[model samples]
Target: MPVSRVASRFAGIEESPTYAILDLAAELRARGESILDLNGGEPDFDTPGHITAGGTQALGGGFTHYTPSRGLPALLEAIGDKLLKDNGLSVDPARQVIVTPSAKHALFLSVMTLLGPGDELLIPTPSWVSYPAMARLAGAEPVFAPLSTDNGFRLTRENLEERLTPRTRALLINNPNNPTGNVLTATEAEAVAEVARAHDLFVITDEIYEKVRFRGEHLSIAALPGMADRTLTVNGFSKGYAMTGWRLGYVAAPEDVSAQMLKVQQHTVGCAGSFVQRGGISALTGPQEPVEEMRAAYEARRDLLVEGLSGIPGFVCPSPDAALYAFCDIGGTRFADPAAFTTWLLREAKVAVTPGFAFGPGGERHVRLAFATDPKTLGEAVDRIKTAMERL
Candidate 1:
């Protein structure tokens, strides 16, 4: 038989570091290793009771079929309401929103809607692993704009402009950033708006971790002046509501742009799950206490991780402002690349962490740890990491 090959579009792309680390950890666990799996960004909590009940009710009520390709009307309205109340953005539920299977799909749809082959997207370095991959999958080039660790890895005007080219079509910002867990302040968001407006670039802001902040407040770039029309806001129930398996996410954009996104979505996965949409509605409308409780627990876990890791000889980790991760710099250690160090930690200490280079070149000497687990486990993981480094 002739040799078989995949498409040329996948030439440089690789599996997401998050999932790769997770799979390795699972395999180790299956072999009975005492592994602390800190590579995943999923919330450790279960879906809230009210939301689960809503899904059950939808199942009992026979909502097993497909919903509108855009989404169920009630879920769309609930999403819009949540945006207005929480993020200060008012959107037309009918024309401006499309719920997809996951935030990852929403992002791919956004890229397909706004970009084409040869177009470039400006992405901050050490960002979520999926953003650049999504751009590549859309046949667009990802131009990484390195955000300085000195500035808390926050995006700035100069950095965005440095990567700007005529081929550049959009800017992708993951506020409450995935690996670093840094949130953009209002001032920083304005800088992004200014640059995007000047460059005439569309902005895709992934606010999936909007509800997981620890210090400063979360600011949406879409809420900035002159940015609403050009910004596509991507959010989901995965992190905030512990609905990772539910796979419910939505994008809010200008009417015309959203309509095009819906056209792309219509041809792709078609829509989000039917009954899951009902559960999403309940997640957005029910008492927000569980969200707050989960946030508090993560915050405590973050403190435990920071305190424990700080005492180690060569680990330098800043307190994450939001999200569930700590992107720690292991540059001072003997290991120049974090991949070897992380693998050694897994083998010797039975602790799993995501290597930083998988994010971008700027993350070469770092590792990312998700603090979504309880304080006890996080503390133990930190202790093990410290002891492992001592042996090095």
Candidate 2:
């Protein structure tokens, strides 16, 4: 027998459950079976034309070398302008921001730079699958504060306070959250801000889905009173601009933290792709008409998916006000175990979804279906789901 050589950091972290679903779907595909995939968080749209052109232009114009690790000057300036205009934040582009390969990278950088052994990072679940994994990788304890399913998984100050301990150093938030598509209302954002204030906790908020909003204004916690200095804001062009393959995102943090993350960037990947950074600038500052149009399409798809799911027997789905997923409760169904239900959907319904336990505590009896596909495909998925339920 070979010696087990995996390090302790890899102990509790299994492969990402989201990716595991993708892997399973791939296996079914390999066997030549039809699979209706509703598991990915990626947008189903093309990158806006101007943004692609911007990247091509940069490449053709000989901007293919390593950029400053912090990012190109123009892109940083555009990001700064965006924060001031859209998020009510004013930041110095040079000292406060670092562009990375993706929002996931920005998160990894933030986690690695800010956390260490014995420190606690507060995560409110049902959270994105990566939050706890990132905390664990940083050698920090991930304390999950599960939001109540009774209240539509809404964020409340009490859930966070209940999980607080002396070792707690930070809170990570994702607005217009993935898996559950719940956008934080003004009151909820304030609840987070208040908790952060009372405990002196730094906040690392992921706003990747900010522009995909379908309801009230998306608020940035950093824009709240007394939060500016203690918040690290991460945003990217993946969801909104449909540039997932571009692998680009940026983090706006306190200057010192930005410096430390920059060091991590220098050692790992050096800089983001030169051309992608240029495209990011265009995505931020170019024509926003495509953004508006795509959002309208997503809004329509959300309505369709929600209505369809609501019609299914024993399925309870709240219309997500923003983002690309429909988080549904299957607790009332005959196949009440989310893991078992997920398998049944794949085997019988030929429909694939992520089990809710993949997200965290309160999501146990649910499953998340991404609505990023075309309306026809989404409709078929819903029909398949209903048929599967009827036979059960």
Candidate 3:
């Protein structure tokens, strides 16, 4: 058999380092190594009981059929209602929402619908690993707008303007950001919205961590005046509801964009699972107790992880106000490349973390540690990391 040529669109895309490291650590653990995995972005807690019961009811009711391409009207309505209640934004269920298999799928569909060859996307650096790859898959160029550690890795209006160009079609914003745990302030979001308005660029906002915010409120860039018409908001049940395995997510956009995305989705995933959509409805409409419980637990874990890492020599740990990860810089210490450092840590410290460089340039000296684990395990991982650094 001859080897077939791989597609050029996927030529430079790399696997997600967080999941990749978790897999490697799991394999080692199978061989009897005690690995403390901080590389995974999933909550250690189980899915809420009410949400699980809803899925059970859905299964018992035989909801195993395909839904509309945009999603079930009930789920869409619940999503819209949830958005308005939680984020102070109104969305029309019939035209503004499309439920996807995951937030990743929603992003892919958005890129496919909005971009074409030669179109450009301005992606903030130290971003989630999938953003650039999704842009590339859509045959669009991804221009990096680097975020500084001094600014909590949040994108400012100045940074957005510096990266804008005539070919730029969209700007991606991840608030309560993955890897960095940075949430864009309302002031910063307004600035970014201004630039997008000036350039007539589509704004793609990933608010997957919206419900997981620990500090102040999670503000949507689309909530700013005039941004609602131009923003595509991507969110999911994975991070906030502990429904990662459910693989359900959604995008709310302008009617035109949602219509186009529905077409793209129909050709690709068709629709998300009907029963899962029911579960999602329960998630949005059910009690707020579980959400608050998870938030409280994660807040405690975040404090523990941040405090522990602070004591480690040569470690510069920034306090993340939201989300589940702590992104720490390990440069000027024993580690040179973050990937190599992660490998060494796994082998020596028996701890696994995602290499920061996998996120993009400017992330080379850092690593992402997910504090979604219990405090006992997280404390041990920090101790092991400190011991390993001392040895180096």
Candidate 4:
């Protein structure tokens, strides 16, 4: 048999910058370099004890096997209940939800299922890096609609309208967005729903950071009037429950759309881990204090990092209201761009931060640093950065 050629879909898809930075940090750490990492997107806190216990109980009870292609029955019900309680969307779990190994996986499933060649997915700029790649891998074109700092990085209808074309088939929304941490306001959510309705476009809303918000109430586009039938809501236990390693997340969509997504889930990654699904049930239904505590900690860290970055001579940072990143504008800095600034910091300050261009358009002059770790460590990074700035 001839050796199989690599698929073209893999071309131009770089490793996620978050993971790439992590791998680089690991290699430096192995070589005895003290790298203060602020490049991760996961919570530094441990997974809540009760959720761990739930998985342990299931494992002990011999739940170590494949679940139904969609997900475990009870787990799906728990997710449905969570949607109603937290997101205000009523769903029939059996037909509307599919568990995947991670929120990223669920997103991949969605783009693969709904998009194809020549179709365009309108993504707000500075999005999580995987979104555009997911669309591309599915043979669709990703059209980035740049969200400006002038608008506080909010997704406006005007932005979407300008990007729309005959081939635009879907929109990917990340609320409490990753790099910017801009939570969608009620008005913006309505704008999204309005455009979605006007264009009859399928909507994929990534709400993984819902629990990590610091500002306004998190609203789901699916919960808005006329949006339930067209929106795919994606959430996971990674940021909120510190379950990144557990690799558990889910997508809830209309039954018809979910049915197609299930075919993708069924063929690729059969289901989330059986016992992991048990853990997810506990994550959704269990006490949410840990999630709150983590959010509070991140809020404090955001303030610290933002204040520090602002004081630095050439950096302008906005206080992010959600998620773990502080996107700082470094265009005024002496270094040419975010990449140069990040490289300088890593070499001189012994710290790691993500270059913002990895996140796509509108991130050209910035760098994103995660506030996911402890205050002391963050303080140290700030000091190191300050010192590095002074020495230069």
Where is model 2 more than 4 Å wrong at Cα?
1-3
Whole-model lDDT per candidate: 0.89, 0.91, 0.88, 0.90
Writing each residue's lDDT as its tens digit, candidate 1 over 91-134 gives: 99999999999988899899989988999998988887888888
Cα lDDT of candidate 4 equals 0.90
Best by lDDT: 2
Give residue 358's lDDT in candidate 1 (0 to 100). Answer: 82
In order of lDDT, best first, we have 2, 4, 1, 3
Task: Give me the runs in candidate 4 sitting further than 4 Å from their true place.
Answer: 1-4, 17-27
lDDT of 4 by residue, 1-392 (tens): 76549887777577876565666678788899999989877678889999999999999999899889999899899999999999999999999999899998999999999999999999998988888888989999999999898877887799889999999999999988989988888989999999999999999999999888899899999999999999999999898899999999999999998999999998898888999998998998889888888888889989988988899998889888888999988878787677777878887888999999999999988899999999999999999999999999
lDDT of 2 at 115: 95
Our tally of clashes for model 2 stands at 1
Residue 308 lDDT in model 4? 84
Candidate 2 structure quality by residue, lDDT tens digits, 166-255: 999999999988778888999999999999999999999999999998987899999999998889999999988899999999999988
lDDT of 3 at 153: 77
Greater TM-score among 1 and 2 belongs to: 2
- What is the C-alpha lDDT profile of model 3 across 1-392, one tens digit per residue? 76658877877677776666777788899999999988878898999999999998999999899999999999999999988987878989889999999998998988899999999999888888889989988999999998877766767788888888889999988887888887878787888899989989999999999888888678888888999999999999998999999999999999988888989999988999999999999999899799999999999899999999989887898888789999999886777888888888898999998899878766879999999988899989989988887887
